[model samples]
Target chain A: MLTDSERERYSRQILLFGEEGQERLKSSKVFIAGAGGLGCPAAAYLAAAGVGHLVIADCDSVDRTNLNRQILHYESDIGRPKVVSAREKLLSMNPDIRVEPLAVIISDNNASTLVSGCDLVVDALDTFTDRYALNRAAIRNRIPYIHGAVSGFDGHMATIIPGETACLECMVPEAPPRSVFPVVGTTPGLIGVLQAHEAIKQITGQGEPLTNQLVLWDGKASQFTMIRVERDPDCPACGGDSRASGRRREI
Target chain B: MRVQVKAFAGFREILGPDIALELPEGSTLTGLLEGLGRRSPGIQKALFDDQGTPLKSVIIMVNKKRQTRAEFVSRELHDGDEVAIYPPVAGG
Candidate 1:
């Protein structure tokens, strides 16, 4: 049941999703990987929206260079761990919610444990080396994964539900080329919000998820295009016999 | 045959939103990409490496339908087919 304060605090969104939907938000827990550009906005929105629990994991400390995009970290946070800075800000944003910030890198061995009881996972990490680990963990746990990435003025996002749609590997079969990539803050800002929007829609049952449609945002052309995607039966990750446990079934 | 090529991400900066390419009826998707390279050196450099091998990260689709990586070299284009190329962004 919503306390009087929750009812008051969420009044605006409640007008949108009603009290029952707000309860869903209050009960759901989300695992957000990374505390960088994408993760910053994603966490902020989800936190403000009253996602009951958020487990944010990142190993790096804040750098002077991160201020251009990482909104959660301030100048004083330069030497602080990303998860620590993010957690402090997020808790202040809404003390009603719980934030569990893990100060560690997410890799192959620990991905499953990190995501362990969470309702969903947010892929806001920059590197595929870590993204793939989270991907398999989401699959193994039978939870939905919101995938987003950005570079310069370009960004893309998709919702991955194991067994029901194409996994990350099926879409980005190989890791993309690496470089000292350039980005304006707005790229991750937009993509991260879209990811949070997808998450809210998923948890509240208010709308359809992205499913097989990949949203490619071209900030240069100011174009948002939805291209169809599908699973590869031979995809090494979520393919054939190698697939992790399927979706959380209805039964 | 004229095919509408839609480019996204880095490719969009080079090829704009859409470019109409005239290809021989039996041209494979690879051939069309090579044709695009011939049309613009920017695309040539972005789509290929120093040795001219196509970058595996470039995703190709037909009429908005994603084609498997192997189909990139083998799939043939038809008149009026919408071919989209997306070089996905890797950074956050």
Candidate 2:
């Protein structure tokens, strides 16, 4: 049900991708697991692209430090919960899309339920524990997950299509230790844009997604490299008698 | 063989962005970290744990392929494999 203004507003993108792509975007449900640096731009682009529904999950309040790269928030939003602010910004961008703001930290306990209903999960979260939890949920639910990470000038992105490609656990067995790390807001912005690009590709079946490959970007060198990832047969989540195979392996 | 090492986050501030290292033909990831510690004492605190072990969160990737702490010592390196060392940073 595109109104005259709605159709006209999206006319250029529609002309390039056609009504079918637009419809696919309109029907897809995407879950963004964080509302910070990467999540803001990624979710914003998806909403603007007409994604039918977006569930933004986060428990943190906005801080002044987030202003540099978190394009969805304003100075007035500093003390507001990121999910609340993100949803408002997204809905303001495109009211046609449904926005769900879950102001809770995504953890092992709630990841399955949170991820169960979405067509795809976007790993915009920063912590390794949450990323691994999302990886497990994606594998258990048999859904595709787009992974992104950034530290300072470097960032990386990958797409994991469970049972079809390698999961994040197979690529890195352990999470990096949590510490205060440096980041330029633009790093997440760069990676988030790529994540959104891959999500769209997954939705419309347009281009080749980075399944079983890690795309690394070194902003210092201005270099982009793709590392081929092989599934570890021993991966606990996607390997052996995991649900992906419909059996249980002794842990 | 000499390889170029790039450290990110805290490592960048401690080790000064990049360094060149000369190692034996079969240096492990542990060996490289030890070498780095010797060359730059500032990196020791950021790269090692209380028990003098490499921090688990310090990601060691050779040419973009991730290597576990155990594999760090056993994984062979070619002439131009760029080893990237990263500290954890959260992204929203």
Candidate 3:
């Protein structure tokens, strides 16, 4: 139930989306896999929008270096765990929304359990290993996963509806090698906002989700391009005849 | 054929922003990488593993589409394809 003050706070969005959209938000459970740059803003927006439940999982702690783009943390949160700090900020943003902080690194062993309970999963993680793990879990669970990545001035986003669209593995068969890369704080924030937008679209059943498509933004050129992604018939995660798999034919 | 290469982030620091390479018409992905390495040894260190093999996480996308590490050798090239090499950077 929405309190009078709460109702007033969200009146604008409610007016736009209507009571049904608000109810959909209230009933949604979203899992955010990282609490750093992208996760910070993504979680903030979702919480502010009154998402019913948000599960934040991250193993790292706030460091001085994270201040540039990690909006959920502050100077005071340097030593605090990311999930804890993120939850604190998110709860404060909207006390009506339930925030669950899982202060642990998501691994192959626990990915399924972590993603099983959520309606959607957001891959804001910083490593390909973790992203691949989450992708596998989301595919197996038949849940929707919003993928976002930023490097320097470039960022990419995609929405994967398990068994209905191309899984992450379909695009990149193997993980890219990790490197000490460069990034501006705003890069992840921009990509994170897009991820949240896709999530909201999925939740409210409004707009066309980027299913089987990759959206690339070249900040240097200020150009955006959308490309069709074809699912590989051999994608181990979503290829076989399983309940979680989408349509077998190519899109 | 001469193709221009743009390296980003760490690669940029080592090799500057861009470089031009001249290769044979039938040069494969591996061949082009080797040619670049010969011209600028710095790129070799950044792009190859300890064994001098192309780094796995280092993505080589031709014209913005992803190409497999193995495909680098056999994947045909056109006259003006922009080959982008990227080191993995995790986003938030």
Among these predicted structures, which one has the highest TM-score? 1
Please give the ranking of all candidate structures by DockQ, highest first, separated by commas: 1, 2, 3
lDDT of 3 by residue, A153-246 (tens): 8777899988777878876556765666578887898999999999998999888998877776667666665655566667777883354254
Where does candidate 2 stray beyond 4 Å? A1-6, A240-251, B26-30, B45-56, B68-70
Report the error of model 1 at residue B55, Å.
Answer: 3.0
Runs of candidate 1 with Cα error greater than 4 angstroms are A240-251, B14-17, B38-45, B48-53
- Pairs that collide, model 1: none
**How does each model score on lDDT?**
0.88, 0.81, 0.81
TM-score of chain B of 2: 0.85
- For residue B1, model 1's alpha carbon misses the true position, in angstroms, by 1.9
DockQ of candidate 3 relative to the true structure = 0.35
Q: Per TM-score, what order, best first?
A: 1, 2, 3
Looking at model 3, give its docking quality level. Answer: acceptable
Q: DockQ of every model listed?
A: 0.79, 0.43, 0.35
Compare candidates 1 and 2 on lDDT and give the better one. 1
